[model samples]
Target chain A: MEKAQEIIFAGFGGQGILSMGQTLAYSAMIENKEVSWMPSYGPEMRGGTANCIVIVSKSKISSPIVSKFDSAIVLNQPSLDKFEHAVKPGGLIIYEESSIITPPKRTDIECIGIPAMKEAQKLDKKQVANMIILGAFLKKRPIVKIENILSALKKVLPERHHHLIPLNEQALEVGRKFVQ
Target chain B: MGDNESKNEPRLMKGNEALAEAAIRAGIHAYFGYPITPQSEILEYFTLEMPKRGGVVLQAESELAAINMVYGAAGAGARVMTSSSSPGISLMQEGISYIAAAELPCLIVNINRGGPGLGTIQPSQSDYWQAVKGGGHGDYHLIVLAPSSVQEMADFVFEAFRLAEKYQNPAFILADGALGQMMEKVVLPEEGSLPYTVHNWATSGMGKRKQRNIITSLHMEPEKMEEVNLHLQKKYKEIQKEVRFESILTEDADILLVAYGLGARICQKVVELGREKDIKIGLLRPITLYPFPKTEIAKLASRVQHTIVVEMNAGQMVEDVALAINGKCPVSSVGRMGGMISSPEEVLHYVETMILKHFVSA
Candidate 1:
């Protein structure tokens, strides 16, 4: 595999942005890739917006800093505005259309605007928008297999969240099918 | 792998648990700590495991009391430790200075959180100065280790005890909240393999070994205290000689990115991106921040055109990096305050626009 790619996920505090980034990072590591998942906490995590950086690399990553991102998943309007311009020209941008008001201006990048929250609510689970975004991210990157992601989620999620796994899996499938 | 070794293979553990496990393997006899974010798990692990193994784990009333408990245990000639995040660590500085003055051997782990004053409960590298420079009163240094991963967190706990005993001083593991909370695969060291057997120097119950030993820093005579200060200075010099660190892609690079702990991990990704674009960048990650790999960094100053010190705090470690370079190379700093981590892209932009600009022009 090539060197690990760096990605950023941004959204409001309750949107599970950090969890999505962490799941992707953990899944990549479970697949034997070097990974780092850093979340913005304190006020940034409590207020209107939150973000996290996940770097998945084949080699020993020297620095986690990125001038440009390989991909970004924006879950809210603030996140979309903050990160849309930072994605590399050919890189992918996964946006949640239900939350993000403004569509990205740049037409050069690969943009996938999914109604993640609406889809989750349609499935009677409004909070799984983060899972929807992760599903989209997986479909776009395919760095780690979906099976690996499911297993990783199982390992990290608390017991109370166990039942949500199947629903999340379905949501992921919905996202994967949409992307396909 | 051999059968025994295979049986002792690595297991996934939280950084906090790994730290406690490593301490036990290193023959640490006592643990004194209070609960704090990113670090409370270490105490939890010790509370459960330490007693089973006949070790002491005491959760004192507060960080102040816990650090003082460590001071007492160290005075009694036992391998001891305490852990906390930024605010809790701030409360321990008074006792830390006392430990330094008395020349007691102990280990401290500071899982850094964002701060100026009770800033946030997130992982941050903001405690650079507080750990590296004297956090407490008086002029003394504590050996500080900055571990970036769960494996390193465990290994360094063992190393910190050994170093503290070897130098007859305090050693710190300056890990951040992220490192403390994250889970990763870690191989616990073999039991009894740690390189510390300090009973000869420890104050073990004042048995018939010569006379009753008293550990104190109460010399009224200024000259006597000056002598003690001189002795501590000599030890610091020796530590500098023994501990030096740096990372690669630094040679002949236009901009040298300097960071420690979590910041360094982020800078690593930035360096990889720079390499792909043929930007010719490098990184200098200081593993030991107190006896900071100064000489190693000074050497890099000659080859690297410019240096950028990236940190979570507002240019704390950057000051040390600048002092190490001493005008040999132009050093600049980029940092975030109130518990924010500098993003890779932000650091890279600064590198290209600021540090590498001079090189591009030349």
Candidate 2:
């Protein structure tokens, strides 16, 4: 039916927030789905809050910028507080349970807290935390397959980081476990 | 196509990075640029890339130095380029004017940012006047191409070079911070895809040639300067036929939205949203900001009841839109300044409330 999905991924600079969105966008493109990844950038990127909006559509994406979102993947408390009201009613909000102290206020939307960082700690690689959230996102939305994301990783990840693909896949599996 | 199996595969590339790759494929002999936010990626990509391809990539001391370097390379018949943001573009005005006067064919990319002076490093169409109207002194115009997508961002680099050389003038890819910072899937041109073009008037070396070619903008005599202005005007008149625009859903449109670059991208969504409500809205996206599609808008003006110039600045392109319409219909401006993008909902609301209800009904 040519449905379009708009998602916002938010966290601090070093949290792989942008790359999480990028991975989704790259995976969508692999499926020949039109996609855009718009990052919030500037000097604040030195070490401030970071976020990216990823849109995937069956048809051509009209705009790269949007205020309201179909879903949100927030890694920190500030992002939750900021984007909580921005989600469409009945939309999904997946947050890092350990990072967000205050719960999401919305009663209409489905807000799930997955301890992605806690899960990544068990995997012994903190960098794969965002992939865990990504895995959880896929479990709920199933917008793009997990295998495509792994293939996308091969394209986006540097040569040295290719060794971490298996670790990333394992993290995605851990994230999927929390959703059901 | 060289050795890569997935040569036609779409790669997710940022707009600035895509432009760098496209410039490489367009066979630019050299790239001279200074780093600026949102556009430093083009310079960074070129530095890491051009070395392997036997091309010169230099980070000049400033935007001033970089533009002058473009002039030197171009005068030597090298396909050369440079890029900067709004403030840096302003700094290169004098040099750009000189290049324009000398009729040097080169590519200059301005990833426009907010501002009058060192404005915040955010997206803005404030430079529309600077680019469309003469930014530098004198009677010269750059062939300006405004791209609306990451794909167009790559595609227009090749077009800009072609048009610049064809017209013997400098060309600009006037994109903004949002377009530059965003990433989208694109199928880039193959490496070294462009055919080599020869410049007969180049000062490379005489080497037993009949005449030695000299390149300069300075004319000591007033008659000579007047003659130069006359020829430039004639060339510009010829350049007007190169106007490029896209008309979407204009068949029965009551309201027509005129925009370019990111503004057009945002308004494109507004058209879809407005059409959902049966608002009969359409969009005219001008790909070439100069050589503007004035006649196209004028033709559409007769059909549409009203036209709005959607942009980032307060009302930069609104005048140009008005000029195109020429009192055939009413024209207005809807915009957001300081790098703030006007969301689809905001613009659609403006169309519904401000135009459809207030103007169309009244």
User: Best-fitting candidate, measured by TM-score?
Assistant: 2
lDDT of 1 by residue, A1-180 (tens): 575687988888888887787778768777777776655544554457888778787876545445468898888888787888889888899998877667888888998899887899889988888888788778878889988888778766776898889998988887876686
lDDT of 1 by residue, B1-362 (tens): 11223535665466778888888888888998899876788898888888778888899999999999999889878888999999999999999999999999899999998887887887778788888888999889999998877788988987887788888989999988877766555677777887655556556776677787777878899999999999989889888865746686876777788888778877877887688878888888888888888888888887777888888877788788888899988888888876566777777778778766565445
Quote each prediction's TM-score: 0.85, 0.97
TM-score of chain B of 1: 0.94
lDDT of 2 by residue, A1-180 (tens): 767999999988888998889889999999999999999886656358999999999999998898899999998888999999999998999999999999898999999999888889999998899999999999999999999999888877877889999999999999999998
- Local distance difference test, candidate 2: 0.91
Query: What are the per-model DockQ values?
Result: 0.33, 0.68
- TM (chain A) per model: 0.94, 0.97
